[model samples]
Target: MKNELLQIGPVTIYGYGLMIALGILAAYMVVVHRAKSRRIDPSHISSLTIWSVLFGFIAAKLLYWITQWNNIIEDPRLLLELSGGFVVYGGIIGGILAGYVYCKKKNLNFLQSLDLFVPSIALAQGFGRIGCLLAGCCYGEETNHWLGITFHESHYAPNGVKLMPTQIFESVFSFALFFLLLYIAKRKKPDGFVASLYLLFYSLGRFVIEFYRGDIIRGSVGLFSTSQLIAVLVFLATCAILISRWIKSNRVSHT
Candidate 1:
């Protein structure tokens, strides 16, 4: 709804892009504030975040291309369409990889840096989902429920039909998760706990939400959508990390 928020002369501001820009700015500001509180150099975090985001965009686009490989092969123009078709998992993975490399180069504690910044990722996602809702990209299955929303001008969603509004649901969940992560971080939990919790909760939420998504363009793996498959793997991997960390912590305490 209202994808074109404003236009003057040859300049036009689109809803999705505007929301993304806001989200990135908000996330960076939060990270900077957090860095000051954590006693880490805000300048370092600023550089790391910028690098992670740039790589995250590349990863998101790359994964989107992989998913839509067939469509791109048929119509090569789809490859250049940058307005949509990003995979969240790809972005997450890429950001983590970028952060890891940056941490290695800067001699920063990888887990500590990860824990310090993970919450901002969720914060950014909250705004990103609102972008999705505005652009009507990640729509949900048709439903007669009261929570359904109708998008008349959505280029992606079916017009005149009430849909489940998965984008809003995810946005709310992301905001809540952002707050929860902040709370957990304030509690002074273990080094890796916050990062693991972020992965665990996000993966679980994404897996469940994938069931309600109506966009078949996202592709599937056997009985599950592509995101669902990735979610399961992420969840299991996170569980394994948590268990390993817990056991190691117990051993350290006992020793």
Candidate 2:
């Protein structure tokens, strides 16, 4: 994996940053396209997207700092030395919060908006995982399996050793989920159903992935990594919400 994918005179294009940009663009396009189909105002989506991304980055960095608190306290300079450190779940939570606030302020249907955007989130995450692979950030533990990959010039991952390539596995899973969500959307499922499924499935996938994650700097709680803990919470919360909504719908239908 080459971090510095291209260099031109005074400018350099890094693989991680480039993939992130592409992910954002791709996600936006998907949102706009879906918005048109749903007859929702694309302008609102534009503004919401901006707010979500800005807050998402902030939250991701904030959570990363929190996880690395002890290290930062020991060596304050380490914070300045590190160019990048972010937790994906933090970004997801921050983005959802931002979108919720935006929907409330605009007086829009929040569930409908969620249904429109979650698939795109999965798509963006798919791209972001590829970025992680290229930058070698969320790498996997050493493995001698045929699927193992070795990175020679990774900024974070151990070089010259065969690794599990969990990044690719997650990327593939995200992409598959994106398509599945889109298919579920076309079936016109209940409002928030798609979003709930997204959360449930993503949390399960992430929790399982944490086992293979090699980076121990991400911190932990009890027997689980920070992400794993968050995933479990998200999964349970989504399940509870889904069950409540189903019961409420049933009651309304009966009445």
> Residue-pair clashes per candidate, as listed?
0, 0
Whole-model lDDT per candidate: 0.92, 0.92
Q: Which runs in model 2 stand beyond 4 Å of their true positions?
A: none
**lDDT tens digits by residue: candidate 1, 52-159:** 999999999999899989899999999878878899999999999999999999899999999988999999999999999989899999999999999999999998
Model 1 accuracy (lDDT, Cα): 0.92
Estimate the TM-score for candidate 1. Answer: 0.97
* Predicted candidate 2 versus true structure: per-residue lDDT over 1-255, tens digit per residue: 988999899999988888899999999999998888778877898998999999998899889999999999998986784458999998998998999999999999888998899999999999999999999999999999999999999979999999999999999999999999999999868889999999999999999989998888889998899999999999999999988988999999999
- What TM-score do all the candidates reach, one by one? 0.97, 0.97
